[model samples]
Target: MAGAGPVVFAAAGVATLAAALLPRVLSRAPISMPMVFLAAGALTFTVVEPLPDPNPVTHSSIVLRLTELCVIISLMGAGLALNRPVGWRRWSTTWRLLGITMPLSMLAVALLGWTVLGFGAAGAVLLAAALAPTDPVLATEVQVAEPVEDPEDDSDDEARFALTSEAGLNDGLAFPFTYLAIALATTPGDWLPHWLAVDVVWRLAAGLLVGLGAGWLLRKLFFNAPSKTFRLAHHAEGFVALAATFLAYGVAELAHGYGFVAVFVCACTIRAGERTSGYHRVLHQYVEQVERLLTVLIIFLLGGAVATGLFAGVQWREVVVALLVLLVVRPFAGLIGLARGRTGPRERVVVSFFGVRGVGSVFYVAYALEAGHFLEAGAVWRVVGLAVVGSIVLHGITATPVMRFLDRKREVLTSP
Candidate 1:
């Protein structure tokens, strides 16, 4: 206990080891890896007197960078894991979730923040945008797995396909609104024109163009480079995934586009290039491992923050709104959006209820607070923190059982 530094390192090593094992250990049970890490963080921070308070308000930059790294890595993993082709009909459920469910959820949350929580328009929209994306990090159980022999049938499981694709794209798509919140907060009156042109039109276009372009080039290098030594895919190194993530994001940000969008798009484009290659599996496994480690650290810190009074000023309204956002708003909006879509009733219900919000929400709030003015920054943190905690606990408990039940039901119904 004399040197707190060594204790922290030892804790991290043990936590990483648990991260490697928990998914297999808790595969059938109601418990999840996130739940374990959260509880560990809470308990650790509560008992450890030397540990610094994990406060986001005082440490905005650290939170922003940490969450940003976690999210982009997750987006890359989500993109690479999907086996489905990119087509309107093939991804109908995903499109519905992004285009319809996302907006509806955002509007609903924004309205609640305004009327119930008394946030200004900008603050309301910021809160909504922060919590909008179904996190790619914590929802891995519901997403598609690594590449398989048949690319076309990669995601034959409809629920996995829907959740996977939805998580991949919505993180990037949510950026426009987050920027809109920033615009409204900083400039007030004269922000609309620039926002519409740059945030809406230009950023979207650039992110897509850059992501697709970079992915295509990377795929070429990986699979078809002139020299055998130059073809990285032949080497089968997993670190290329990190290289690809950083490249796509750095290029997109330099071009004034959304790096979140570009990273996912780049990953998907990479997948599209080599659908059946075993190299993708190697890359995906590595990325998944890294993501799991980061998830453990972030969620543990989140629990620590909560234990250290992150929710101290949270009111009844904030608590109720957080509950409504997770329970009522997302479910109803997802149901409405997926209505009459290809999913069966059971699948629809699963997809609707599993809109898991996590680290991405934290990242957005930190990003927004850093960029613009929000007087009620503490309140925003408390609200978003509570919402994230509720989501991790509720969805974490339900994901395994519900997904297993659906899988069983599908097998029975499809038996000849």
Candidate 2:
């Protein structure tokens, strides 16, 4: 046991180094950093003896909280990275993707879950709601980087920018649907009025109001304080990103609002506060590093969870549903939503192709289960696992090549 201590310490050191170096090394590769760690986790558990189990069912609260942290941190990064100001016409792609594509995808998934996977109403709803949004965490490579000076060149293209913005905002937007699943689970078959009152009307409204209010207040503190001592931007304190995330999330939840929605909205409002300041870059860098660390931990645990047979009770039908979500449902929904939008063929294809699933899905599933009762919990787990795995593998492999091709095409067209 004394000798084991050094080995463990050495392993930790090596893992940290790998985490730091892997992103740069894999930037040009066909694989992703998440895939590498996920594979490592599965292998480590399979080979190592007496390793601690990390199943989600056994450690639900821990999984929920860790993923919750990952998402909110990523939200802050997403907000800071966007150079584009928030306006109806400027963010038209974001608006269209959020308003049109997201709901269509949800409805399609829910229907498929019901008809194909034999899920009950509550389970189907939970699955659909969970899978509805694009992941803000895993899709970072394809997303826009930190605020660029030139607004015209800020994003890769309209399609990628739109997808990133949509993913960032909709991570919060999907909360109402999760709430609906919870309501269906608790209610005795007549949940329309309550769903309308709480899920649709009250919670959404409260979330928006709280987010706007909290964001406005925080923006003032960060950007313009009464005194220099209280002004966070003056000191360039980046850790406040986490502070804002938790503050917005806690306040909104306390007020019976969707904390997720509040977090993103708060981030957007904060970003809008100091659009051209170098302080925004400082804050974004700090939040991004923190988010990356959190992501590593979560993905490592997810790998551990898989080794412990997280998908043990998944059925063939559920597997089919999962595949359908990644391969059929999301792509088609994206295509339809962006039909009359600004993207060209290559851009549209890339946007539709990379609807990768990650921590958000985990949060939704856990939140739904905690709030509701599903008959086929095992099956739900199975389907979600399959979908996540498929997304990780498929999207991870194609992201680099697809992005490269698109970039090349854009260069050729714009060079003349």
Candidate 3:
């Protein structure tokens, strides 16, 4: 047998090549490229005797950084992909999802965790908060693609596009809930006043303010600077996306705000700065490539993690909870939220169905575990892991076929 190092290297090379080529090969198939890679990782680890364990619990920092990078990169991509201007009316669907569906889902899941799963209040809140946001990293298929040539066609079907954009932004929005979970874990029940003052008011305000400020500063630097050398837009540098991500995130965290929100907000602000500039396209292109590469790495590692017994303690109850989250919780929450909104039935169903959980959930879980102890940490991990895996497989398989069907349906409806 080959050394583990050589085997891992070879496996990665094959995976990368397969990721690049799989979409082309499976263009007509219902299977997703992610489903294939995840399966590959699980099978490889299962069959290979020399592979080392990649458990996230023992390797928290690495997992944290990896998912963190994956998310911010996806944020950049999501921001650059959006052609719609940021406004309440323009983004009505986004607002509805953020305001209504998100809270409902959080409340429902928290209650389930508390009453049904018998988790502590903190653990229940943490689990609900962690799972509240749709993952920005893994829902790429249903999201807006790189700068659409047609301005009119830019927004994905009302449901898909709105859900995609909502996911993009709300991944950060859920940070406050995670903080609430932490507070509940650390403080007494009467800590609600402080939590309201600090966690609810200060953190949310700071994240938005800091993100807008950083984005404004960056926009000026990138596009309005006096010095030619200082004009980042002129240089078409892509790595600055990472700098922006870290800067916004670091600044927000330093000020005790939700860094995730700040990062996404900053991206959106920067994007709003020069919506029509070719420079926007340049930045987006670079970010999308980086996001793709990072996603490949995270998913592959996730596969390795699964093979290393991430799901060892998974019980039938955990499986049931995971299924309910995907099938029952999110879909119902989304549908109810969008009931009177702009989306049609097909669009509503698509949006509700494709609430794919990915890196954001991983980050939230890891962050929560690090910040607060949970007796059922193993059980939480098992349930969340199963949910993520189920999403990757189920959503991945359905995304393409469903989108194609919707497209055809739209064409037929519009035909003379």
Candidate 4:
């Protein structure tokens, strides 16, 4: 297929079509669209010759942009899907996951990297930060569905809600530590003060403010603009999700802030603006389609990368660490975070165990590699690739059965 552009286009078109249909086709089964595409990619590259190498390092810029866009789009869909109002008591589970569980997971993974995988401080920290946040894109099966017609139908079951909300916000929240990893890698010494002043404080605050401001402005334009012609929501153009995503992200990044945080926050702010409007469904549907397309492309490339030796030189220690991050680190941290909080034992376990890692981890690694010197870059890629692949397979296989079981249990428990 060398120089056969139409063949390439046809293949991609087929993949996109499959992406649109596979979720429903595979629903309630112990399988996922990502699994299919990942396997397809591996198999295709394994059998096909003269295919372009999908090494992320060789295509860092493309990798960064692909993963970044996937994340931003997913964050928008996540924000639109959530029905819950932000509140201290109402979002207690979310607060617990963000405040307690995320840090704990990061520390544990970092420790494993340092102690077991023999990574240096910077490498360990980067891996910890990258893998800490549950991916919003790949976790969609466990997240809330589209915006309902009724306002009271807002929140999902606690398990879904907690996972959804945690995945939405944590991607941005993990940026601080990712920057710290960069700081340690790049600087000679004494970057803490700079990190505190800029990375920790200013970037986060700016992202929040910019997100709120952009979202509020968009709300006015969409819902309450004086001119009916300018009231975008009334028109019900779904592509506005892209406009909003780009606007919020661009504005925040221009101010030296975390665009990922701003994008997710802006989505939440938009959800709050018209909580009951059907317009949200329009916006969400559009964003979800785009997000799915991006996901297919990404996971396909990831699979191709693996088939072409992305995981070469991967050692037993690194594989063990990857398993630990999935099995021990996240589950334990999640349980500890949700301790004495809302969810029951089963819900807690489901929420904790379904922290599926995917595109976001790749984003963080690429971003870090761009920002600083990571001596063990190959090791980082291997471990991260294994961890992500493991997550897609392990979580993808079980998410359906686990969720189905929980849904039934919830019904039995909640029946009047």
- Scored by lDDT, the top model is 4
Q: What is the Cα-based lDDT of residue 245 in candidate 2?
A: 82
TM-score of 4: 0.98
lDDT of 1 by residue, 1-416 (tens): 57777887888789988998999999999988999999999998998897887888889999999999999999999988888888999899999999899999999999999999899988999999988899999998787877775765643688888988898888888889989999888889888889999998999988998899999999999998999998999999998999999999999999999888899999989988877788888889999999998999899999899899898867999999999999999999999999999999999989999999999999999999999988768889999999899999999899889988988898898799
Residues 1-416, model 4: lDDT tens digits: 56768778989989988997899999978999999999999998998887999999888889999999999999999998888888999899999999999999999999988999888999999999999999999998888987776767744899999988899899999999999999989894999999999998999999999999999999889999999899999899999999999999999999999998899899989999867788999999999999999999999999999999898888999899899999999999999999999999999999999988989999999999998999878888888899899999999999999999999999898899
Model 4 off-target regions past 4 Å?
none
In model 1, the worst 10-residue window by lDDT is 147-156
Compose the digit string of candidate 2's lDDT tens values, residues 146-209: 8654545554477668867888889988888888888878885888888889887888888788
lDDT of prediction 2? 0.82
TM-score of decoy 3: 0.93
Residue by residue across 1-416, what tens digits does model 3's lDDT show?
65567766886788668767876898778887778777777787788776667788887778888888788778867876777768888799899889999999999888888877889988898889888999988898888766654545544557566866898789978887888888888774687888789888998899889989998999999999999899999998888878888898899989998777787788889878856667777777778777777787777778888988998867787788889999999999989988988888999888888888888999988887888777777877887888899999899888889988998998898789
If scored against the real structure, what TM-score would every candidate get?
A: 0.98, 0.95, 0.93, 0.98
Please give the range of 10 consecutive residues that has the lowest summed lDDT in model 4: 146-155
In candidate 2, stretches whose alpha carbon ends up further than 4 angstroms from where it belongs are: 1-10, 149-156
How many steric clashes does model 4 contain? 0
